[model samples]
Target chain A: MLKIIQRWFIRYSEQDRKLDKAVTGITGRRPYNIRLYRLAMKHSSVAAETVKGFKESNERLEYLGDAVLGAIVAEYLFKRYPFKDEGFLTEIRSRIVNRESLNKLAVKIGLSQLVEFEGRKRSNLSHKSIYGDAMEAFIGAVYLDKGFHFTRRFIIRKLLMQHYDIEAVIETTTNFKSLVIEWAQKLNHKVEFNISETRGSKHNKQFKVDLSVDGEVVATGNGFSKKKAEQDAARKACEALDIP
Target chain B: MLKIIQRWFIRYSEQDRKLDKAVTGITGRRPYNIRLYRLAMKHSSVAAETVKGFKESNERLEYLGDAVLGAIVAEYLFKRYPFKDEGFLTEIRSRIVNRESLNKLAVKIGLSQLVEFEGRKRSNLSHKSIYGDAMEAFIGAVYLDKGFHFTRRFIIRKLLMQHYDIEAVIETTTNFKSLVIEWAQKLNHKVEFNISETRGSKHNKQFKVDLSVDGEVVATGNGFSKKKAEQDAARKACEALDIP
Candidate 1:
């Protein structure tokens, strides 16, 4: 199984020799447990008709992979781009793990070439969606085969680290918190987000937000809803500061 | 363009010997015109990005495939199971076109093998999602390759025509409408969904609902005020009817 997996990937990595080499390198260091990876790639449809002795498809892995991928991506994006706000991080994360992007990564990693099937009719279809799913599965597989720490290292080095461009990212991005924090962080300053007042009794409370830096209020906003008001205030602060 | 298209699918179909032989049995030709069939297999993501000189992706095909797959599946299920209601149709559709199912179809069609990508990493990934996505894309591809008439025919043959055990499906299914209407519809059914009044109507409006399946009034419900009341009333009627 390990040999089959290795040979399959080695043949599939047509675009980038480096990526192919990386996959081969992993197997060489210690033969990857292909079972986990295979299960990760399983699709439920393929698993559905199997009477018995069937490899359960990747549904379980997809569930686990979603959480694993989300955590890893969230952590890396959170710390690497300290100035970035929630929205900024979300967009990049979306860009990174969205179906299209996942597909792209799968293509990059050469996971699509290693899929196996019992039937022949539907075998020659596109692997874009599967590639992305499998990539996530592969990540999940690595974590299982090796460990989280090992998987984390692979993710950071192979995917995230190379794409880490905080300054360029901030410049290109347009999230209020991200822009403000990113700019402030760049300028070597700290930002203070304080809810100056909460009005309108507990029954239907309203928050008054004052966005400030260095004890100077840059923006103020209000909402029947506190969160909304804070977001509005933050947005205004970002604009007025003209930082990003 | 059509000839080139025909040639493409013929070559593609040939890769899966069984499917190729099966298709050839129908067309009795080595290369056949299957533009719509190919389009059905196309994923929307691929179609969207094709202008980037990467026309091989199935993203767009996936989009159209989704709709085609849904419609055909719904129609077939509707006919096959005379006792099944709208809800039953919906459930079956969900089951058939769901991410897991489509991935299986993709695998069945060997769609992952047909996708043109830069390398095998993508293919090595879960062919399930791509298979499913491509299954939708394949449906889309079929729509384009064979047009609507043949596409629907193919759907029945390939998907719904197969014994679905829809009677069993009906028993296990929940029919909200039936639950609401069973009592009234059975006993002089004259249900009227009247909106008595609406208040605090914003983007997402709150509705007032009343149940009067027959000339007899059954119930009234209030939610967020009125609309919620009507829905609750309908829910109550459903319970009274004793339809799961």
Candidate 2:
């Protein structure tokens, strides 16, 4: 039919083909609607105004993607860790989908290169979550174009299977300080991290942190920065108390 | 086939028939997996120990259901308000799914009756989100048994369409205090609520609240309780500033 030929012509247009090729590299499938992928890459910083005065950006898509990602990850973790408690599942899910992790994942998957933004206005952007936000928006685009089951498959196969090492992700101690603080709060115990000592020159300084619980110094740690020292102390404290 | 007859026989068994009838009233469909529905109704307070010594309760289901519910609601709101910003979408979604709202929704849908818990140990349960938690677990059960699309249809048709008046939900001023506080924090403005006055006798006392922004009193409201008075003042402030 004429409509079919017209659709094929539009899909195979020079610009559309270029976009399709780029998107296919990341998603492992040819886009059903290249426009959605384009919109996914269009950051709010360089958003265009529609005829109705609405800014066409990836923010709405990001919101949708965030929810989809959360659900898929929750189900995945639930099935994988059948015997694990809900608290452990929640903790691990957070670790995987946190902004820092998403940002890194986006870069790892070559998604960061596709995101379009006003480079000059980068400094005005308060949060360093643009790449992660775009990754989420891309997911939203996939969901809209291909539906939930297909999107879930893409996320599991393309992203999780190809990129993430689950065991290593679980073992990462990046958030030990917050974890220890949360554990203390649950037990109704007061936790304090104090910088007990400083050593070496200004540029090459080592900070020692003492982690106290209920006025008792339970653990000590040393590192190049105060935050690092605190986290190290918290990790030690977690080990001593069997917090995990 | 013998297998098909066996499946049908099990589905219509006496006890299953009763559960199917009760659950059909809520979800408008006979459960594909009756055991999941049973688990969904089982509260942690009355959880049975599995052969592996794990407590069998609705907590895991609640976690899964929470994510699924969030995704479905996010998508619904996204499509319903195409022109609305992400912040507006987020606010409305939270208003719809927050603990208080979900608790009320659960009771409204008659899901509270299906929940099994220890009545004597109710005080020890602490959080009053049992009904809401069971509602979420029920959703997880539906998701696992019937899959995402069927669950989405049930939520939209049985829950949102039948029970919720979206306009009234949007107009509800229950969370005005938290909304105004959030607004103030975003703008880096100092907000304070002061008890301006207390009047009348003990049984019929009226509390007056003055809501201030950046050291200036913006609104005043009176109610029977201090919390109510603060909410009233916050609502007035929101109206004065054209917040919504």
Candidate 3:
């Protein structure tokens, strides 16, 4: 695959060798398949045209990649920071693995140099999200080539363990209820969650809550479980205040 | 900001100079203050427990990062794929730049390295969403350090421009209505959303939709909006089928 991408990159890139070397320098742990890389690079504009009447592209891979990446990262964080709660986990993750970040990372690793687009839309294209999708595709490629254990090690070595405060980062992203409450306290205000009712039974109890600050409801939420309910309620409050 | 971060990373990463080079290489063009780095690294726990009693974690930064990331990614997709419509753009952004993705990226980029913990719950504490939030904090740091231009450049270079066929990926995510139809067609089943109408004028309209598959009513939903009604109906159907 790397050979194929090497061929493809050689064909279009002005600084073909340099680009190849740069991308390879960072990603050359294992070679990527050319066919996959081709699909990764060809914009939907050209790829979706259906060569040989085939309707396949990297869409499924991207979808899978999105989920797989989330699962992998979630598992990693889960193991790395056992003390962190859900809210902190959610917010921090929102910051890092986003489409924009992955896309930017892909470009930094030189995926941009390999991309091929058409339709005279370079200056006016709408395929920006592809940047990250391609990165996922690349991950998919690596997964297929190297397997999960290898991929995990590669990600940890190249990505996670590279630089991080795993303990503190995990702790912060985990607790949103605390985060919101803490914020309200900082404002020197009393926070109250007016729970109108806990409607369901113990097995499937649902709580309806309205979180308020200084008498006005800031967030309304319902959850099947009590803890989830309070967290949901707090999350709503945070969103309403635009305060993480 | 980059200079400060570079210097700090170089100073801290005394053993692995390769990582130092990688960190400095990514942010070589900018110069950020140590305060920004500290803020980026400050998980809410440490910030909340500070001696000054000032809770100044990246939580606020996470909030800002979420919105800014959304706007920038939206704009990027809009420009990158000139032919795509609003729904496509939104769905792609939703999938690619979701909280889960951001969390993964944050962890990938070492946001965990900056967190501060509360109790000794590190052993059993496990929350998965923080990586993205830290990624957002990092974005906040980048924005604070380099402003929007470089921040935009940073996101583009790192995240969105890498892999997926952005157009098709977006198209795949957009328009659940069409998706249902497409899925039904593929399954050789008739899928109909029967909207039983209630009386209303131009200003107010109420709709009750009975979503059916293969002539069997699946779920019913009532909404002022056809879109909402459809979504609720779809959600019910999906829930009924335990889809995903």
Candidate 4:
């Protein structure tokens, strides 16, 4: 039994070397524990057989990675913005870790090409979050294999510093709806959103949303969705009111 | 000006030593960066004045600690329960780290006696979550001072392993309503909770709730609140059905 287990591990180690090369190409660091990276890439739908009847997927790793990533980001922001309040820190962190942001980051890091999932038909049909989930699981794998400071350096230097434009993210007010609402609340004013128009076909529709503050229409915007339109209008309103 | 600044540091370090002794007693380890621990014990309401006009409070540290604690817990759960799914892991993590749990743990570690806050009238009026928040901030301090491995050992050995009974926590179904609902969903069975009776005056009211599964009554419970009554009913129902 011991010999058989050793042989099995040797076979898997060869497979792991190829993956390590790919991971090194992206991360600029060879992984210490290749099994973690393998598990990180594995999707829940394609569960591998284990001695315990079935191998678990990247879900747990994703969960772990998400938390670790959050801590790294929070610590980074805390140190970077010394005079900034908790609210500012929270907003910036939210902008950084939001689903859309992570998904975009995942795609930029070539994660879409590496994740192990079912065929394109099944994956594209239902798992829009697969790439982002894999990105998080990969981070978890890095943390487990390399520890916190190393993971922090990888995130800061390799991912955020090398790839991302932090200054642009800070300057942009893309999540205008939330920002506008928050600003209004701070000023003790009521804010309202109204869907003024919905046009075009069922499949390809356009929405016009009007944002009002203290019962006065402040801005109007049009987009493919109500949420988008509201955000657009809120952006214009913030620009007009000098909300910063 | 230089002499004044030097004097301030001397005074603060003196205070920090007392705090260090208290922390040592709790963790069985001497803290290296005593300033972080000092910040952890200092509440926001009593912000100390500094040469920079106002010294920052523990709020930022609390935020950092909360994220670090979450990561630590996620790592612990991930390694400990290899067979458990993400949902099960999340549930157990929540049980360990939720506000009430942390508050209890904080009191157990004698944190309530060491924390510095405003006088009774100010702190008692609003800062109910002080203990739990300080507990998180202290964890953050530990991470910053000692790094991840030492922090992990401290949490696993000093807090979770030494102080907490992990097996009892796993076995006890404190959140019966969620458990029963999860079980019902797995079996494709409908569950309904109805408040059967309300009695007594406005300030001292009682509620009786009945839980039904698949249109049949499974159990009944009574309590001071509707939520409590529902939970009571769910607990009995879970026992009756032997869902596990």
lDDT of 3: 0.61
Candidate 3: regions farther than 4 A off = A1-23, A48-54, A119-121, A124-127, A161-214, A217-236, A239-244, B1-244
Candidate 4 per-residue C-alpha lDDT over B89-126 given as tens digits, one digit per residue, 9 for 90 to 100 = 88788889988889888889998777888885445454
Query: Where does model 1 exceed 4 Å of error?
Result: A1-32, A48-55, A117-127, A163-244, B1-244
Q: lDDT at B74 for candidate 4?
A: 88
Global CA lDDT computed for model 4: 0.82
Candidate 3 lDDT score at position B110: 56
List model 2 lDDT by residue over A87-123, tens digit each: 7789789888989989989889887877888873455
Candidate 1: docking tier: incorrect
| Candidate 4 interface RMSD to the true structure | 2.5
Q: Which candidate is the best by lDDT?
A: 2
lDDT by residue (tens digit), candidate 1, B54-103: 34445545544565565456545544654433443455667666787556
Single out the weakest 10-residue window by summed lDDT for candidate 2 chain B: B2-11
The better candidate by DockQ, 2 or 3, is 2
How many backbone clashes does every candidate have?
A: 92, 0, 92, 0
TM-score of each: 0.33, 0.72, 0.38, 0.70
Candidate 2, residue B227: how far the Cα is off, in Å: 22
User: Which candidate number would show the highest TM-score if scored against the true structure?
Assistant: 2
Tens-place lDDT per residue, model 3, A1-244, is 6554555453434544443454456555534444545554555555664443244455544544454455456545544544444455565665557887777767666676566556534564656777787777666555555555565666666655654445555344337688888997898878887777888567867788888888887788776765666677887777778884
- The TM-scores, chain A only, for the candidates as listed are 0.53, 0.69, 0.58, 0.67
Listed for every candidate in order, the interface RMSD values in angstroms are 16.0, 1.5, 11.0, 2.5
Ranking, DockQ, top scorer first: 2, 4, 3, 1
